[model samples]
Target: MAGGLVAGYVLGKLYLLLANRLRDHTVSIVMQFVATFLVWILGEQLGLSPIITVVVYALTIARVLPLRGEAWLRVQRYAVWDVVILVLNVLAFVLIGLQLRLSLPQLEGPNGRI
Candidate 1:
């Protein structure tokens, strides 16, 4: 997990540097999406906590992106990511609720000892 976190931070910096060189808006945004998934997938494949890896990667990228002074890209990226995060949060809660519903019966187990 720690290794994945470190790798994610490094990759995040690399992504920003790469993004800086791209002239096409569509391609740059696509690259950011790809890099985000790549970091998560690679981290999980390495037996690390992918969630933590993603969080670290996102934080690193977010911190550096605004410094580049790309107003259009900044606004666009922020809007897209904000919606993504909101949806993810809603989905997480729904999934957790479903999980709880599924597990409650087992917990009740004849006498509700649990």
Candidate 2:
């Protein structure tokens, strides 16, 4: 998963560097989709979880571009709903992580002994 994420990040950065003529939004979306799809396909082929693959892809995409700063400022200026969705996504992940942790069962040795 980590390896996939690193690869995606590197690839995304390279894509951005190479595709200098494209708009930032277009580049970001294309890179994100490509990275996510590749990770998903690789994970499925390797018998790993697709959800984890997508998460790693998302992290890579986040690291590749300006999620903040000038680009973000421009986005905010035009699309407040995008920021709302981003915030909601962050909250959703936090809740999902908490729920997963909370639902974990305590482990014990065989014969019901710890």
Candidate 3:
């Protein structure tokens, strides 16, 4: 947990620094996505909560990235984030469905009853 939090903070700062140095908006957006994955995987490898790590990293970036970034970049970033949100929502629903499926047999009644 400690390692995850530290890595997340460093990752966000590194991404922000790179984004500020670079001239291309596309690269900056892509770098943010890459940093998110890196921090998430880092947290997983450290045996901690990847969600917490990613959230910290996102919160760090949220304060400045949108305000400093170009309007076009913001638009593209919004689109990308929208897709990510959709994918995560679908994945969560699928997980719930799977859990329901696993519990159904027990709920169907005991003693080999259908």
Q: Identify the leading candidate in terms of TM-score.
A: 3
User: How many Å off is the CA of 39 in candidate 1?
Assistant: 1.5
**Candidate 3 regions off by >4 Å?**
46-49, 110-114
For residues 1-114, write the lDDT of model 3, one tens digit per residue: 786677778777877887788678677668777778888998899887898889888888898888988888889889988999999999999999999999878776667665
Instruction: Tell me the deviation in Å of residue 97 in model 2.
Output: 26
- The lDDT of model 3 is 0.83
By lDDT, rank the candidates, best first: 1, 3, 2
- Against the true structure, candidate 2 has what lDDT? 0.59
- Please list the residue runs of candidate 2 whose C-alpha ends up more than 4 Å from where it truly belongs after superposition: 1-24, 67-114
Q: Is candidate 1 or candidate 2 better by TM-score?
A: 1
lDDT values for all models: 0.85, 0.59, 0.83
lDDT of 2 by residue, 1-114 (tens): 676555545555655564454456655455445655776786677666666656755565456445433666446434654665798899999999998777654555566654
Candidate 1 per-residue lDDT, tens place, 1-114, comes to 688779879888888888789877778777888998999898889888899989999999889788884789878877887998999999999999999989988877567677
> Measured by C-alpha RMSD in angstroms, how accurate is candidate 1?
3.0
